[model samples]
Target chain A: MTKRAALTDLPLVLDRVSLSAGATTMLDRLNLAITPGAPTLVLGPNGAGKTSLLRVCMGLAAPSAGTVSWGGRTDRGLGRRAMLLQKPVMLRRSVAANVAYALAQAGCPRHRRAARTEELLDRVALLGLAARPARRLSSGEQQRVALARALAREPEILLLDEPTASLDPAATRHVEEIILMASQSGTKIVMASHDLGQVRRLAGDVVFLVRGRLCEHASVGDFFDRPSSAEAAAFIHGELVL
Target chain B: MSEGLDAWQLIASGDATLISIVRLSLTVTLGAVAVAAVVGLPLGALLALTRFPGRSALVVLVNGFMGLPPVVVGLTVYLLLSRSGPLGEFGLLFTPAAMVIAQALLVLPIIAALTRQTIEDLWREYRDELTAMGVGPTGRVATLLWDSRFSLITAMLAGFGRAAAEVGTVMIVGGNIDGFTRTMTTTIALETSKGDLPLAMGLGAILIGLILAINAAAWGLRLWSEQRVA
Candidate 1:
């Protein structure tokens, strides 16, 4: 999983970032930098700000305390980066069209969007359902479509918040393969997953957040085997760390 | 009995009043629904998607207006357009334009409130997905509208039904001016009051037909959405 791509400065940098919603801070003074081609997974218990951290990085939810600089710019121009959610959002269109819309909105040339959509659909095992209405698909198929949509952007960074939170075993395996394929193609993936086993299988690096604070950042092997913090240790043992 | 059958001959021969009334009903209802759509849809979208202190109050107000009495709305507009009222200079009362205005007012709240309900209900399910998908604010709002398009279509058709069959509002505002503001409902009322039972019954029959057409379309949309969901 540590097959790094071409070298660059940080693609996503969050400096002392904090998120507060109506007097409740979700992420507080958390500084982190994710580089090009790095697959970082955020893992913690319920209400541990894992999803909030992903949002701050994506500019969907603004951080209050500090800055988030993306590719040397602190702006919404980084919208080209894509994201996936646990509950897949499908439009009233064909699955291919959903992927195409993501690429097209990111300014991918019209001629290329179709080809890219088809390729991603194949990669996600949704090629057969390309013509199917996205809204008509089962939850698993919809998630695959969502994954295809995210990768079609050919994003410099991909953010996922519990993309497989509620799937059966077979569906989870299918989505995991799709994501693993996307990461192979050099998409920098930052994800949040409650499934620690999936995190172990997929993550190159792990970020541990607790009560709006980042407690640990380590290589996946190190974090799972010899967690540095008491919080991380408690979490590693099947206890609610939050 | 022989004269009673002549009403069928009038329908067969394409009677001018009958055709004109049908055409007028179509245009006035369509025109009013268009205006209400333009005004109420965006308001509904905003009310549903936005968060502010008065949002609940606004929702209550829009929902409350869904039950507003049509005649009361028509009477209010008639007063406003009367020569002595505030906007009397326009001389709009007793014209088809006034009828259109009154009808649009009557349906705007219904469209707005129902559209808001549809979008809000949809937002509850998909807002998190939309946010995580990085759909911009505009796209999120537009997506909710598009996703609930079937529901919106039915809401609009319901609004059209309300506009088409409405009697008191169009009667008061239009003055049932023959060959002009006269519509199916108003004509039916006029014919009924004048003891012209045959014409009144014919118009009533047409009104029922129009209602059937609208309900059929709305039901079709609902069926299509369900089939897709399946």
Candidate 2:
């Protein structure tokens, strides 16, 4: 029912981070810092390791080299963190129950669950469908429920991997509005997206990745106006960059 | 057709011996399923969620055991419950309790292996979501098992069917004690051996019908729950 207390981890820093599976490199010697305030957007083409980068930030994947630290600590518990995958998984239960499950996992009390679930479903504009089976819902609806579930944790850092990649225009707008509102409320959104339009709308900072390498990290205006790397320039012009 | 009609008559008339046998069959099979579920569900869930060096080997072992010979299970249990054997202190041999134990042993692998498969499939879908919710390993297993319960119920029913249809284990362990541990399967075996063709046919028909009923009830429950969930 209650939001998480103020952020304890800030200025999330990645140092020489590399990830490899077998002989294939996924992320290569990436060094970056994400300071508090403003939503950071990660952009890259297919197979550029956007998802892997988000997973590393969420502590879901281990890096083969270097380290990622949240506020100078790598051992902090992940209870205050939440990540949304590209295709969100819906629990085999009612929409409200999915949110309640998250709330219960976060140790919210039984008495508070009903109100909290109501608030979350309403927040996602899914209150009318609260009793519907989550998996039976449309993809866009399921994505909204996933967002509500993530918010149920009251996370300090929300990592999203193309959370709206499959949604229609209207659905995408709804999700973007919610993400923007969460950003304004200081949840500290770190999202990876393929939608340049979405990037233009929500990105305060942009981290451009190419073939698992960090090509550019700059404020959205600067990155768009005076592109630092050839890859960034090519990507901006809608040209494919390998 | 004549034997089936006679069976219908026996069932309609509620013959005492046939009723007792049917009741015992249900008791032993249901008991076996209960015991197997208690042990197997958690074991299956553990196998699904954790990774260890021999985990694949263990999974293979459990899967292999699903086809375990009921007669062999009977002999093993019979040996264990024999007077001079290790578990003989409880003196469970040649009783309905022994039959239940043997059937439970026979059914355990069925329940556990099916549970492992069902929960593993559900886990693949749920892993990211649950992990993001900060569910630790144990909680994730618990959640998955609970969510996949309808399928697990189907698994239990499969075990129940195997237990009820099995005569080998109950025959060896129960000794087919008339008016006591003579369940439908054992009684059918006994009647057929004694050349009582009509009684054997009747009991066989009843056994098949009872199993069909159980399956129908279980399927109905699954459908109802699914509808509610949907």
Candidate 3:
């Protein structure tokens, strides 16, 4: 069977997007564009709207105001993008089945599903535990399974929210490696993280946010070296941005 | 005393009449459950996943129907199938088919209401991930139903229990025709009315035992499957 057509040409643009829940704003007229390229890391303090931004970009949440478009089209580019929430909810099934579910959702042919599932499991080093229930796995292992599931979609754009937030150092390294491998394989990676070290190690560009508003968007090197905004500078220096 | 011993003896001997009644009971109730499940599960899943005008009212209506009186359902079906009634041409009244119809009507809301509750709870937990995966409406229903299978099995069992334990519906619709339409509950009611307490007690014991066994088997299956998949 042939692969689904890629959506790599579409650049995700958020034009003056604002999201509010009741009284509090989660995203404040945030204007940004995520073009096809290296991994872009979103850095922010607690409640900085990193998650909300990713949700809007993934088309999982509608912004209360303004518009989000992909390749100048306002449609959600379904099957072309996938997101791994901060805490992934595993299907009540085996590890292999979880990836297979994603594969099936991505419209993988019936005959190709098993092979594709196995390939995704192997990529995450979860082939040995293929028959194990996904929910019973360790948090780090579940995170990897979630990665494999996201990868199973062959998504052109993969969004992750703190994919390694609760993982140990070794597990974090493993996740980062898989992520970099996905990035190398032409998937545009947009990830949110709090770890500055991870940002330095994995990010090509940094989008910094403070209180639901964009503070800076620059190349990782420039953002880390020059530190444009006081909030970004203060954030990098390990000081409280608020 | 002697009566209790006779009831046990009747059960141990696998009395032909008793066995046939048990068989008919299983056939009608299981048939009713099958019919109800076919219609109710998808309807329940749809209610859980969709919203529209009067959806809440429909949900409330289905929930309220869960406690519908079996005698009332039996009377309604009787009227529907009685001679000179709209469906009289097919002649379903006072037959096992009539009993199945009445019991199905009695069980449908229980299964559907419980299934709606189960799928709704599961849907909440699965919403974001499924949406991100681009699963469509039908896919969402199928997923929620499959994942909530254990809970749904319990819902089905609840329906079965309701159908099996009630005598009024089957008694009215089946006419308690011995050697034909008689079921365990109907037979028990008939024997008791005729003062044949031993036979009634024996059938009562078997009915309770059968329900207990089914529930046990379902419980075990759910436990084993959950362990395998959890």
Candidate 4:
């Protein structure tokens, strides 16, 4: 099998990226650079374009104006990146099979997929439910399975959209543990979240957005302790930012 | 009442002629279904996933063809395969092959149209995920088709139901030759014309029973497998 290009597409950069759908602007001249590091948690209000920004970074959505380049290449070679949506869609198959499908798509040889699937499932603490249909699993379990699937791709950059928003405390903790594990293993993590506690626990830095514009980007300590933007200050205090 | 009794007796006794007719019916209908599925499934998947000029018009044409009269299809196939027609040299007219062709033509539209709808809905649910996975066009089609297999089974059965239940196409193409091209539906039609109610009723019962049994088996299999994997 031909080898895929190594994950050298680091420091994903966006240059004045703007996205719009007719009269509605989803992303407004957002400039950001995500370098290799600890997990970066994107915090924003609803309609603040957090999801839209991740979609752009993942190369799933093209910006209407401006450009996004991975490393230095403008072409979207998605082999080195994987993403988890707010509500991950489980394939209509077994949990093990769902991971197996991702491995197969990632070009893992047929002979090695089974062992790899087991390993990934075990990492997510879902080895016991390997044979169960993935779609029938609880939402928390599904999120973990989605995490396992994203891990299956062996991505250099992992982008997640609200990976644990709907989970109970226990389940949310489980997911966070897996995410932390993934980050420690050298994969760059960029995730969006609504939970403030989650943001404190998982974020190395915070990218705060308001109405499709980037309002603040700072280290976790600085952002929460001394937020420069009025919007970020109000948002950190749980005041409505409208 | 006597005719019903005779019909039940014929069915119970497994008369040679009745058995032959039933076997031919299954052979012809299943053969047609196989042919239709081979051509229709991919066509349907393509229609669902791709966009091009005149695609809507083509979709409407396929949908319209689903309601085409079997006799009309038979007539068209007859003209194509008749002795004086373009395919005259092969001499397939009045044979089971001709009947299979006619029935395949009649059933293809139903299978294709239904498959298009099934794959389209599945594509909607799977679009973002599959695209995110970087699955290409052919992979997208294969993935959607395999994932939609349960729904597609119903589409195939609908095609089988149409082919098995229709006499007009087979009668025109097969000539209903006894011990040869005669199928359950064609036999019932011929026997009814000759006032042989018992024989017609026997074949009719077997036809209905066969359709019901196949449908039930498919439903059970789908339910069982879906529970296991869905």
Q: For residues B5-124, what per-residue lDDT tens digits would candidate 1 score against the true structure?
A: 445666788887678888898889989999999998888989999999989999999999987899999899999998898988999988888988999999999999999999889898
lDDT of 3 by residue, B2-53 (tens): 2444667777787777778889999999999999999999999989989999
List the lowest-lDDT window of 10 residues for candidate 4 chain B.
B1-10
By lDDT, the candidates rank as 3, 4, 2, 1
Residue B211 error for model 3, in Å?
0.5
> Per-residue lDDT tens digits of candidate 3, residues A1-242?
24347334268899999999999999999999999889999999989999999999999999999999887778765748899989999999999999999999988898999999989999999999999989899999999999998998888889999999999999999999999999999999999999999999999999999999999999999999998889999999999987
Clashing pairs in 2: none
By TM-score: ranked, best first: 3, 4, 2, 1
**CAPRI-style quality class for the chain A–B interface of candidate 3:** high
Q: Give the CAPRI rating of model 4.
A: medium
Q: Is candidate 1 or candidate 4 better by lDDT?
A: 4
Predicted complex 1: CAPRI docking category: acceptable
What are the TM-scores, per candidate, against the unseen true structure? 0.84, 0.96, 0.97, 0.97
- In every candidate, how many clashes are there? 0, 0, 0, 0
The order of the candidates by DockQ, greatest first, is: 3, 2, 4, 1
**Candidate 3: where are CA atoms >4 Å away?**
A1-9, A77-79, B1-5
DockQ of each: 0.30, 0.73, 0.85, 0.70
Query: Candidate 1 DockQ score?
Result: 0.30
